[model samples]
Target chain A: MNINHVDLAGYLTKSLDADEHRQAEEHLATCAECRAEAESLQEWTMALEAVPEAMLLDGPPDDADLLLQRTLRQIRQESSGANRRRSTLVGIAAAVVVAAAVAGGAAVGRFTSPSDAPPVAQPPTAAVSSGPTAAPGTRTATAVDATTGARITVALTPAPGWIRVKAAVAGIPQGERCLLQVVDKSGKVTLAGSWLVSEAGADDGTTLDGSALVPLDQVGSVRVVTEGGKQYTSVSL
Target chain B: MPGFRLQRRREVADEALVRSLFAEHGRAMLAYATQLTRDRAAAEDVVQEALVRAWRHPESLVNGKGSVRGWLLTVIRNIVTDQIRARNARAPEVRESPVDVPSDEDHAEQVVNAMVVVDALSQLSTEHREVLEQLYLQGCTVTEAAKALGIPPGTVKSRSFYALRALREIKSLSPAGTERSAS
Candidate 1:
């Protein structure tokens, strides 16, 4: 009977009466099409349940232009083709991982799985080792940008809501306006602080202690970039 | 590297996609972020960061099968969760506590499924969408939803049956289709 189509949706959503449910199951046992559909509906409903609570709201406030402008300005500044390429991640990771090892700062490697052994003095692809190395919460990253010939290393020590940033920055020209920023797992940049390189600092590199509002667990990397948004160096944590 | 012109074209196309996405979903994204952070300035920062992510990974938006708004909302939720986690990770007492990071697959599935369902809901005929929105989103019982919609309970049941079927035809049209829809 076409009766199945009439009640199948109710059955799929579990809104069926006891009798209706029993009858629908009886039909589903015989009808492949109804059974297949019921199976699919099960997934969709579960997905529906997983929808986050925040989607219920209508939208942003009426006055949102300033926020939009800030966002657009950020995108425009970082839109350069060289930095936009995804290779920047791998490049930053490789350089910082190597530098971390040289600085004897913290555990560093490109292999993402946390279970992979500590980075060893082997090729970049080497991953035959065991569990991750020693370090409770602190991590350090080191990087040198070829384009700008700048050297920077940042070590992060996690606090509860913030982090302690100990960074050694060098090789940038004197009086260059540079900002020290912390980036999270999703590429959100939080301005930690900024400094203008002095002649002595450029030659000897300045090591400064600072703090960032980012959490310890989310710190993906730290970077020193010019006031114009050109990154001098970025090292992954 | 691609030719200068080709790269420029891709960037422009990407920019357009981001702008449209903002035009369509920005208010909603900001609303969600503001509610989560409870601070206007911080919420703005969160929305900007989420938008940046969308701009960089437009592929996620294009390849996603759910409602684009749903996907964007999911990203906003994640960014907030990380911020909260960051705050918790450094507590002096529990500083070194083991954090059970949810697998990427877990959240991705949740986000994508919600996306699909949201998109599917939007594509539904008004009658179908109204019924589901009342029942699922508003958590109204069949009798209650029927009363609210000025329809009979039996009609609600029958409508839901067909609505579920119609939802099976979800086609995620965004990042390009977004432009047309916004117009």
Candidate 2:
């Protein structure tokens, strides 16, 4: 019997009719192709069933409080129905700043001789225009990487009872996992978030947004660290 | 006065429901999202969006036929799909590599499977992953998977053949052979 692929799949899934099942079984007892296919399908099925249990051994990231705070902030924003307009305005402002920085930096580099060009372009902090605060206050900070010419701009917003930290980082290497850590005046360090640089973003940069449960007043500094625990840059608040 | 009291009671109930949902399934949902997005920050965004959506339609929690976790996982899958679509649209020049686009059913299956399998799936070509997802996970017939994936049924069979062969060689599964006894 020349068993078709569909017939084999049907037999494996038990979707075959009785006669088809019996015929396939008889052929499977002799044919090498049918037997190998059947065994492979069985192994695949067993592996599929093991997936959920396997995932349970390695659970979510360790920072549950940060996740809860971020979710609550999203819930509050959506329920209030004001998130869209605010997000749009923020998006526009960010675009303009990025465009200006790229264009201005290029212009300065073109006219200045190598010796005359200022080192590292002035820190990005000077370029950030602080946005107006609503119920939860907002603060802005920026850091520059002297060696890599990368810049990181961060926005801190108070959400409910926690501090929401959003950072836009540029010029980080692709495929490297970077972490954002927030340190309080009391010396407690909270892992705010971690992200990988997208293929495109690695060429330019990417913005990472995350929230932490620390109070705004308590935060003294924020640091971006690579997966290797090396601090890439730090910004004082 | 009675209306005010009733509203307060409903609010309390909603709060309890939301807390319970998070306590029971938050870690799993986060883990699943992290695997799908491959970025913890984006995973948080996916989890946040899904939870907020669940909160808005609190009735979903009570009325869902499957477990609340399943519903939440479905919601996360949809959001991630939309995010990937939007990103693709914005940067048409920089298309995701073939290996990056896991089939629809594979995304759903990954929610249940361990991150190790998810990592293994990432290693396979996108075509191979899609075939297994449709046949094994979605339980689609070969013909059905072919139609869904816009390939011929023969291609589906051939792909599945190679996919299973590759899965057998995946290094992550080697350790599991011994660990399965411990598990």
Candidate 3:
């Protein structure tokens, strides 16, 4: 429904009367943007409800200064308390719960999202090709194996405990099994991802996402190698 | 030297996240907990637990999905629910209002949705926010919000529509927002 008739605010907030509510419900089912807006606005109210009257009435309780100190002290110790509550109702993150994102990445060229709420679907390989404008804090490197003339470009995005490795490998022979490895400073190798090079993948190349358990502090490089352990190419971070 | 600097930066960023969040939203969190439990000491405990959660999942803050304050508030609400359920379990006879049965699944979902909503709401104008807070948070009807907000009822109805439409555009749903830009 257009703005003229639908009271979305009233509809989402349940402020609409019975007849209005029924009409709005039918309208929302067909209207994608309105539905999305209703969902977010509904969640916003839940967030706003958490706001204590005291916060708007004035500032925090005067005693809250001590609360911050106590909080810091808790962190210094075990920093443990009530466990994580649960996932959000939208839990739309479930939509991308790609069980084998590596295969999906190689087969369809979709980058595996490191974030829980990843974008709808981003063409990450294109993003890496245009590396001059990668998101701040992301690092990119390119390496070419002179022997095989194989080329690989890697974009490394750091996360909490691991690194998101997006590697585009071109010139590898078709039907060759490959493993994506993250090499840390100490020479420790963690398998961030693995994929089979398809015909299309071997010809035009394929971009896939992998992860390395090593922290950003210790990451040394990203490498693509055969199942036989022969390195196709390696790019130092 | 760069490695050392990078490590140092990461460490400081983590600590700064917690301190900055507390500095910005600590008071409001405490107020919310106090409102929920109606016990000052217990409220402080709830806020502390929520802060700890925020610290551990610092990714939750920088993910660009939602405001950290919104996540904190949701966590606070979840913790209070669990606390009430736990207390009621200990002494079922002591509860004045019936204890809410807690579900771990519901807790997680509320936190995530609230974060997304809070993030999208951040993009709305103050007028949009006010209209939402009235009709949604206070459960005020168009007429009631008009009286409370000193605007015409027709204005309240129209404002709510526009506000919801704006929030809709800001949210990146699976289907994606319509062509309209919230800005």
Candidate 4:
């Protein structure tokens, strides 16, 4: 049966019963404008649906036993792993903690020092290696602005429990800004910080220097973000 | 494969199937429960209680084509609805903004399309916006939303009708088409 046309909005809202909806669907098949409108609505719906599913979890409260079970499972796993590698994990954790404290203190010193002195703190000159070597630590990074040729270096000392982050630019513009973030062993972000450096009375972008001492435990990875809106991220654990 | 088969077999009289069902659908059900309750912590508790309840009555689900997951979603929904009703005197607050598509990675064309819809929706009255949001974003049926709002289901249906029509017309017409419809 041929049915009279309803406006496109009624169809999208799904207010019509089965028969009316079927009629609208039939009309849409032949009507170009309605068909285009329907397609656009569908496209909009699809795009909205692509929003992170995490958004739906916004208001709903988690059920109690489910939360308990999940929590218990996570705890059991962590405990078992901890038991298996208690000694080594403890040593590493302590080292990182110590590194953080010393590095934090050294950072205060480096930043607070008289601006006239040639920033005595050296950029970290550490090397990257596998499995928490007997030798302390290393820093590595690449500059995002390659034409600007910027680089950030990180250095670590396990016993002293400090990590140093330093940046240098060669053949690029001066007064560039840099920011840092550290990702820890368990994949948690431990720190996010930034600073800018400029050579003394030099207009050339060739040389920039700034440094921070981050504790080794908090030094899983260091990221450098430049003022020209470039990000250089790296990880070590 | 063995676990799937065992969960499928209602005739086996096996105790382990209960645990298997719980493991498979537990997290998803918890997510649904949270949406229904709009409280993450409470939803988790509801899911856990529902699963434990199901575990005690595994035979209730025998000869069912629907996996244990569907049953959990239903149970969680009912429980949350009941809770909301029991606290009916209180206003519903703590609404999370509706989830929208990520702004990142959208091409210029998609962005323009989205802006069209967004601009039209923005022109809607708060009443229209709230009803549409509840229905589309929160996935609430008109009846459910009416009960929550202490309004008639017909009101929700009509409001949704006008709101969507206005949105469609706005999309079709030029920016000059700001005239409100009589519908």
Identify the candidate with maximal DockQ. 3
RMSD of each: 21.8, 22.0, 17.9, 24.6
After TM-score superposition, the amount by which residue B11's alpha carbon in candidate 3 deviates from its true location, in angstroms, is 8.7
CA shift at B61, candidate 1, in angstroms? 11
Per-residue lDDT tens digits for candidate 2, residues B1-183, read 643332332233233334434543566567678777767888888887887777666445334443344466667777876776665465546765545545532553444334445445534665666666667655667777787777887777767766766876773443444222111
All candidates: DockQ: 0.10, 0.08, 0.13, 0.03
lDDT (Cα, tens digit) per residue for candidate 1, span A142-212: 55454554556665766788998987776666688989999988889998889988866755566778899
Best by lDDT: 1
lDDT of each: 0.57, 0.54, 0.55, 0.40
Question: Which sections of candidate 2 miss by over 4 Å?
Answer: A1-30, A33-61, A80-237, B1-12, B93-183
In angstroms, give how far residue A220 of model 2 lies from its true place: 52
Q: Is the docking of candidate 1 incorrect, acceptable, medium or high quality?
A: incorrect
Return whichever of 1 and 3 wins on lDDT: 1
Model 1 alpha-carbon drift over 4 Å, by segment: A1-6, A22-32, A53-57, A61-237, B1-27, B30-46, B52-102, B171-183
**Against the hidden true structure, what lDDT does model 4 obtain?**
0.40
Q: Interface RMSD of candidate 1?
A: 17.2
TM-scores of the candidates are 0.39, 0.35, 0.37, 0.26
Candidate 2 chain B, poorest ten consecutive residues by summed lDDT: B174-183
Question: How many backbone clashes does every candidate have?
Answer: 7, 1, 8, 32
Identify the superior model by DockQ, candidate 3 or candidate 4.
Answer: 3
The CAPRI classification for model 3 reads as incorrect
Candidates, ranked, lDDT: 1, 3, 2, 4
Q: Is candidate 3 or candidate 4 better by lDDT?
A: 3
